[model samples]
Target chain A: MPSADEIFAGLMQGAREEAAELWEEAKEFSINTCWSLASQLVLVGQAFVAGEFTKAEVTKYLETIRLQFIATLAAALMKVEGLAERIVNAALTAVRDAINGALGFKLIV
Target chain B: MLRAIVVLLVVLVVSGCSSFQLGERYDKSLDDDLSAFQIEAVTFVASMRLNSGTPAGAFTSDAAKAFYPKASGTLSNIVVKAGLLSSRQCPINGIANSIGLPTIKIGGETIAADTPKTVVTGNCAVVTLLALQNVLADLEASHRDHQKIGPIRGQLAIDDINKAVATTLSGLRAKDL
Candidate 1:
């Protein structure tokens, strides 16, 4: 067994690699989230079975194939939660802008 | 197989934990620069307003000065620290890895070969925003004596909060996720 330091070091590397790989996962996650229609859903189901997913999953699925399934599902979970921050920022900005404009003070400028 | 799964589950749980504070614990250099900037900006405009001798009336006509540091020594400290963490990618379950209580320890009670942990920066921006708010609130509370608030100074603090929040928002991007 790798020492705990070795293990942690590996995880960090995996995360870095995964962060870069997030783009493909993001596209895949987006497709899954959209679930356009029956045809699209079928394709995603296929992809899920095939083990193609976000970088976070790469770390997760590494444990096992079942873990991989778990990883992909969590990636989808990540997508919803991930996009949420974008929405929050947009909302905050909207609120901030409105207040700043009203107050005639540039809060962020 | 059962043992592997159980052990792997433990590792995964630990890895999942780091997601919050994947970044460095705290950037001391950034703190120093930020505090210094705050003191300078606060002192200057504040004293200027006092000396300007503007009449004590609502909506004074003095042109307000804006105080915003064009750069953050903070980014340098954060990036440097993040770079270091980036090198240590292997994940291990540690206590600090939890939300805001950053204790970087890894337990090796049970597991397969070496297991690695992913990193997270946590809600640091939120923490900073809250800290700033508390400081401002406390200042307001303490200064009830004279009730002195320079329009410029007040505006600067609000601007500071907005800027900090914006920086924080950028980090929430999926790439950072």
Candidate 2:
């Protein structure tokens, strides 16, 4: 049978891997979002330079974009927060189980 | 070539204006909030360490305690970055609407319109503030009880935060500017 320490190590390793994977997904999402925003800015810029769009219009559009970006970011971060919480819970549980197994007592968390 | 030059100059000038600057301010504020959240998270983990006596200059193996704090930090960083990414959605849609551009399709997902911009932005701020408040509350509770946070309860709090944020983004679609 694997020692409690060994089990703990394995669990921690798994948690780390899971967390890393989620972070990567989040990063990719961020890059894609930036690209999309950049494209929009380019299009808007083109219109304004061509005398098709006025300064006031550009300002309004930019303000709207700014608000939208903040809202979107908040939502994405929340998902990451959920993942972190799960990882922490898993770590805590692993610790509790390891301690219980070693000490032979049901310690209340 | 002349058109391209004009377009480039326009992009610089427009993006450098007050409106774009205000957006940058909001982005900074959001980052500040996330940083505060991260500090609270780390403190919470430290409190857990104290209650459990598994590490933090205790008798428990140093390796185990070391693992948690590092894990917590990494998780915090990832969540903040992801949140920043999600914030980009609103701006993309807003720009599209302002210019009468087509809906932005990204990552196999079509960005559409759902809620009013003011309403959505207001809700986003509220949810973020609430999440921070929740973290503060949890820290206080942990200190008062003199115990590590229960895993189940911690998970629930996290779920609550996530739900609050998700609600803000739900039903979002491109609107006509």
Every model's TM-score? 0.22, 0.28
Model 1 clash tally, residue pairs: 26
Off by over 4 Å in 2: A1-30, A42-55, A103-105, B1-177
Reference contact recovery of candidate 1:
0.02
Off by over 4 Å in 1: A1-109, B1-21, B53-177
lDDT minimum window of 10 residues, candidate 1 chain B: B101-110
Cα RMSDs, all models: 25.1, 26.7
Candidate that scores best on DockQ: 2
lDDT of 1 by residue, B128-150 (tens): 23323332432233223223444
| Candidate 1 Cα RMSD after full superposition onto the native fold (Å) | 25.1
A4-46: candidate 2 lDDT, tens digit per residue: 3443455455545666867565555554444444544444444
Candidate 2: lDDT over CA atoms?
Answer: 0.41
lDDT of each: 0.36, 0.41
